[model samples]
Target: MCARSSLIAVIAALACTLPAAAQEPVKIGALLSISGPFASPSKDMLDGMQLALDHRDNKMGGRAATLILRDDQAKPELAVEAANRLIRGDRVDFITGAGLSNIMMAVYRPITSTETFLIGTNSGPAPVAGKDCSPYFISASWQNDQPAEVMGEYLTKKGVDDVFILAPNYQAGKDLLAGFKRTFKGKISGEVYTPLSQTDFSAEISRVRAANPKAVFVFYPGAWGVQWVKQYSQAGLQKKIPLYSSFTLDEVSIQAIGDASLGMFATAHWVGDINNPTNAKFVKDFRAKYGRAPSAYAAQGYDSIQLIGAAADALKGDLSDKNKIKAALREAKYSSVRGPYSYNTNNFPIQDFYLTNVEKRGDELVLNTVSKAVEKAKDVYAAECPMK
Candidate 1:
């Protein structure tokens, strides 16, 4: 079946499972980092979210869904501006997107402070899931650091110690390294936080080689990820020191990075290959529709709409009762493509994480899920959350 028909069937099935309800058009405010370094990945995610909506006939809970999107341009000020536009100008019922953790942090307060339900398709910041948890903020994605934790666990199982950590200097990067540290007992040879979008990793590579750690763990996304892997290969570091990353290498960038990313290992909640019925349908349909494999970001984007649709149906499309919508999200009335998932008391999803390796699938180099690193893992920060 086409991706359209398959998604329609899945989302329609979800609507049928929920108690019937009716209301006016549901307005969704999406704040996305649609340009700059993350442009390609963000577009993939947007397409994935839109594809699900298209298949479902753009209706949820018998009410039409109207998604109003604003581009953050990968800037904090622009993110705030977009949040204000969606909140004050469009008066959206639910807010989604802000693909990057930094952008999400900028927009979250402005959107959620007004009590509009926000579902994170990506960017599950640590504090938001911990001490700063909110009843209305639900993450349909991951808790930012779970992948790193999974990688850490994998590294430990492999008997590797003394690794180097590299990431952009931001809250998400800090959270990622912290999570890795939590699981990894090895010594940290070099913990380097580079400036945002600074592309030059020559110095960092030099330090990594000099330090000669057992492994290198990085947390760069989108174009940043591609550049790092390519440069690492150019520096001839990939062949000597195994590079591990979280959300840094995937289908979207694998082909771009090509030989550089071959054998590169990364961790993510969803990968292109998973032997599940839901994922089978998603992979086949996405490939048929887009002529390429779906990245984890694409899966997250698809799941976000599935979640919102399910919750809206249960709440009868009247998302004005932000608390009720929040309750629906917490219940997770929809069947996620990644399989079973429910919100922890902190309103972040407790999901599985996996290990993937970049390998050639035909002419394309892709990140394939090869092992389950953490099964039904829950973040430790859940205890820090007072929301429960």
Candidate 2:
């Protein structure tokens, strides 16, 4: 009788342990330039992502959720390797990454093919939004071209006829110019494509001066933008030419240029002052948490986690069913910081864009909205996506 009772207790203990073991937490793999020039916004991404996770006690769909971070160092090969480790070694349920288009492009194939959901918070390359789009992929952020197109419209309405375009010779840089050309009725002179992360802009500024276009548009971002803007100001080009850019200057990098960023206008899907409950809460919580103003990139990162959580809930915590998860993702049901957000057929965001100008307030330089340039903006390449 003693032996039989002991056996029964052992069976009951095993039963309890079985359920606990089966309830393994869901894992998400994040790859970004976490330690290099892009580190500032990478930390912003983490802060935003963690805020969403904290609201849910770091669990989704009644299952614990874990975020694994990998620094890609802004290298394409590093991004590819990181994706491999995340998908194979960690066996993550979702993957996010690559602040730059070239790095994202390198890692895109591996993640999607492994049946993992790859949601982008930033870095929306054209091919993924167009013919090469995958069912497993989604973007919580605007495509690379959307804001540029808005800036083009803003410039056109300003009575600007011809303009000079400058961007890096990369997938995103090309997309920036392409998006601008799609909407703006202007001549693109001195169309220059500098190498990615190129600092010295004296040669490019010379080209801009030689062309002597109505205005100059650039699309450099991060430390690259800081160096270029400082050089542009020193060259005295800002006095001669009105400077406009997309993704080149934001909360993350503008302060590095001090007063040089003043009066510079740019375009974005979100600014610091959008009046809505979701945004108001985000801005407040972000400042309280990170001790600074949040950028559009930070908002996207916060939204990405919310998106994954929503899909997980809709699927009843069953991430094993890729088809159901994919369907649930398309029907995104969450309070977006952008007021309202929905995916195009390509699963990229259909959002709006604002014309923001850099202005100073005592000791702080702020990005303030001039006006809304486009409403319910949709990407031009979505129509080309074959995903049904």
Candidate 3:
């Protein structure tokens, strides 16, 4: 009788120890440029992602979610290798991230073929929005070209013409200029493509001066933006050429450029100017936690995790049941930092964009909105997307 009673107790303990419904951690992988030219936004991305995870108590639905990360160093080859490790070795259920468009492009094909859901933290190239749209892939952020698309309309409305364009000589660089030209409806004085890592821009500045365009638009982000803007200011062209940019400067870049970045105008899909209560809390919490204001990149990174959690909760965190989880993701039912956000047919954001100017707000650099949300903003290739 004693032996039988002991066996019964052991069985009861085993039952209690078992996780509900065989719950295992839903694995996700992130490939970011944590230690390269893209480090500024990369840090923001990490913080934003972690903030969302913390908000969810580090669990999605009833199952724990695990995120494995690897730094791609902002290099194409490195991005591909990192994707390989995540997909083959770690066998992650999903993959996300890559700040630069070139690095995202390098890993695109391999990731799509893996049948793993790949979410973008940033970096949206045109091909993915159009022909490359896959059932397994979704963009948690706007396309690379969308910001430039908004800028194109803003410039056209402002009656600007004869603009000079500058970007790196790469696949994404070419796409960015093409994106601008697609909507501007103006004369182009010149379209110049500098090498991806060109440090000094004295020669390019000289050429731009000779061109004598009405305004100069650039797409340099991260460290490149700092160097380009610093040189542009020192060349004494800040006043001569009304500088406008898409992704040229942000909260992160402003610190690097210091007072030189003031008065520069840029456009984005998200910013601290969003007056929603949720965002107000995010800005306050983010500043308190990281000692800095969150950029759009950081905001989006934070939103993506919230998105995943909302979907998982709706589906009762049943990751093994793919259909239910995918349906929940499609619904996109969550209070986003952007206030209202939903996925287009191509699995990209169909949200609003804004025109923002750089300014010092009480000793802290901030993006001051000159215009409110430009509604119904669509990517240049939205028409090409069959899903639409």
Candidate 4:
């Protein structure tokens, strides 16, 4: 009789503890380059993520949700250290945000090797989308090469035969230029890889003028982009060369570049003017909250949080089962700001790309979607990914 009574008491105690454990806050850690070159886009990304969380009332599947942010200062070493602290110290269930490809590459293994899910908000390097792909890693943004690929195709269709290309000498830079060459079957006037720390591009501009390609394509992000665009304009090459780029003329950079961004063309997965109910709400609320239009990076950050929330909701907030969480994430049923979002074989996004031109809408300049460049585009690296 005493044994039976003790068993019943133990079972009852276990039941009471289970409910409390299930109700524990879902902890999400974000490792971002909140300072350094990527600061503006990173801030936009964070604000978007926060807006998504706010929409959920800071809860996921009836349980409280908490976000812990860490700045990586745009350095690989710093990103790794912060990722380790977030995983080992804070014990975050999800790890998101790495504003640069180098930062993402540095922290990918550390976060994904553990049970924590690494939903990258920005920066999808080639390795992560290819042979190095992990089931634990998912990209809420895009492959690094995708936007460049879109521009390459767009320019090819437009019959621009001779082009000069330039980018920073880094992993993403190499990937982007490679992607452009993959689709752009044209005479290359010149290809230049500049130093990542290069703030001055007068020499490169001089070289572009010497080559005098029919058009110029470049990939320079963040402050680097602002400097390059300003230099390109100041050099009087913007009109002559028909400057085209990827990830170079975003909302954040355009604000800094001001008039220089006008008439420039770029490719992106999401622009401010994408016509969708989800995007409309996102833009409206984001403008209300942040008092400025959100960038592509911001849209990606918003999607990452929404993806996590959708998975958590599917599992009813019980994140103890890693496999179930991964499966739920793979489903990807949430309404995306970028319409029709889903994972490719490698867990990278398979979505549409847009060709955008900067135009003035009233007093502010914005990227208006000129046309759909590619419908339901898949990254070139997906074939190399072992995962189905």
Candidate 5:
């Protein structure tokens, strides 16, 4: 009788421990470019994700949460190493934050193949959106080409016949140029792909000057954008040649470039001025928390956490079922700062793109949404994705 009683006590103890163990805080691993050229945008992305956590009182789905951050240094091999550590050592429930396409590409296979959810805050490489789409991989940001496609269509509508294009020689650079060509229907005077490491755009500016197209379009993000715009202004090309770009003139870059970025038009998925209750609250809270306007990078980062939280809520904080988490993410049951949001078949976002112009508003530069360039824009590669 005593043996049976002890067995009963052990069983009861085990049952009692189950719920406590189940209540373990959700662990999120974020790999960001914390100390590189991408640092500025990465910081904003981190801040945005942090804000989302703050909104939830650092809890998700009635459970405490822990965020483990790793710096990729904008290097592919380093990203892979960091991802391995996050997956093997930390055993994070979700891995988020890859600010560059190259870094995303490097870490995608390891995270997704393991069936661990990779909630990409930024960096939507094309292959992952198309033939290589994985159920475990979902982008909280738009595909790499979406913004450029918007810019292409916008410039085409404005009747720009010829344009010079430049971009850093990388996966995203190639993707952006391809997307631009897809919609522009314009003559390309000169198409240049500069080295990613190159900061001096003097040669590129000379090339642009020689091609002397009606307009110039480029996709330079982070510090690269700042230097490129500053040089372009210094060369006095902004006045002569109408400049258009995507991901070039953002709030972070605008602060660095100041008046140089003024009048420059770019295409993006979200701007601070986007009129929506969700965005209004995000912009207000982000400013209050960070003392600066959030960039599109920040918006995407913020959305990434919201996505994870929504999925956790759907599962009632039980993250053991990977399939259920993926399903919850597919539903995207949370409000997006960019307004209407849904996932494409490939797990990329089907969202809107806007034509944004950098302008001065009361001693501060802002990326103002001028017009809706594409409504509920879906990436061109969605049809190519094998996933249903």
Candidate 6:
């Protein structure tokens, strides 16, 4: 059988089994953009979640943990609708997995109003990590700005000043630029906000070239990242200037940009280069099953399910007891794939960051860690958060 079909069969077979008759089934909602630009990462995350579910013997805390999945199609309105459906129709105990920040924000009000706990699978916009943070909302991912903070610090330490910032003119984009600016501590040549769907970056490239910044930072993810990196390379600026970003480059983007993505720098929490026992099993199993290397997004998605299973175990698999589950999650004693991670006051991740490079690992494109964990890479708004 083909890889996709094989994967589907595996997940479908896993989905069919019952854990035990004793424990209540816990419903967890997953909203991912399965048919749009984020399809790859979204699928990557789903695959990870599936792997974790499989590893847990398809149960959480001895209870059968069921996933209520909806494809948002990368649209905010669709995401809101899906979230509402998950909450009202499916009656899920908790909601999780959003690939885009706009989608996450769209679901926020409804989720918060309904008093449901929403755990972020990915999207880490500033407000959700700051002023809009809620007691029930937990961002399993880092704050929107946290990963970029490492990039900023790296650039600063390298004495690279006079940098140009580029980001989509959206909330997350602004948050990314804000993050880079927060710790950069140098002369920002300019900050250019481009339209989210603006395809041609020729004008922006010309402007950036005119500014002659030492380095250029951008935060375009998925297809946008692919196009931007390709255009940046075509503009002949790759050899002339340094390009640094967080989400702008990754395994998926590397596949999109092909040889053009070589040598680009990105910062991430997890990289495939992590040669640890926990990650080794994950990497081996993923490769053996799919014949392709998994991305960090997949790693995180898988870890979230594993963490959920740990919570279930702690709660003794009582899926109906929401309070116990919440307490178990808060205790955060799980052996995470990204090492041990605990929730911050805002429920965002408090973990390490590694400077990664997009490179070929055998026949696969993977993020290789050049730097070890920059211990306790905290978000800048931690001090600003009222929770403390």
* Residue runs of model 1 more than 4 Å from their true location after superposition: 1-23
Candidate 4: segments with Cα more than 4 A from true spot: 1-15
Each model's total of backbone clashes? 0, 0, 1, 0, 0, 4
Q: Looking at model 4, which ten-residue stretch has the lowest summed lDDT?
A: 15-24
What C-alpha lDDT, on a 0 to 100 scale, does residue 32 get in candidate 5? 98
Worst 10 residues of 2 by lDDT: 17-26
In the range 191-291, model 4's lDDT, one tens digit per residue, is: 99998778999999999999989999999999899999999999999888899999998887898999989999999999888999999999999999989
Tens digit of lDDT per residue, candidate 3, span 1-388? 9999999999989988975443567677888899877788888888888877777778887888878889998889989999999999998777878777888889988988867777888888888888787766677788877787778778888899779999888766777788788879888898899987787889999999999999999988788889999999999998999888888788888988988889989988888878898898888889888888898888978887877777778877666665566677778588888788768877888888889998887887778888863786767666677864
Top TM-score: which candidate number? 5
Among residues 3 or more apart in sequence or in different chains, the pairs in candidate 5 whose N, CA or C atoms overlap within 3 Å are: none
lDDT of each: 0.85, 0.86, 0.83, 0.91, 0.91, 0.80
Error of 2 at 161 (Å): 1.0
Off by over 4 Å in 5: 1-21
Considering lDDT, where higher is better, how would the candidates rank from best to worst? Answer: 4, 5, 2, 1, 3, 6
Residue pairs in collision within model 6:
48-302, 61-312, 61-313, 61-317
For residues 1-388, write the lDDT of model 2, one tens digit per residue.
Answer: 9999999999998878754423788788888788776777777787788887876688877789889998998888988999999988998889976777888899888889888889898889999999989999999887999888998988898889899998888999999998888888978886889987678889999988888888998898777788889999999999899989998888878888989999999999999899899889999988898888888878888989989988887776777778899999999688888888778899988888899999988888889999988889888889899986
RMSD of each: 7.7, 2.3, 2.3, 3.4, 2.8, 7.9
Backbone clashes, candidate 1: 0
Candidates 5 and 6 compared: the better one by TM-score is 5
lDDT of 1 by residue, 325-356 (tens): 77788786776778887678998887888888
Indicate the TM-score of model 6.
0.90
What are the models' TM-scores?
A: 0.92, 0.94, 0.93, 0.95, 0.96, 0.90
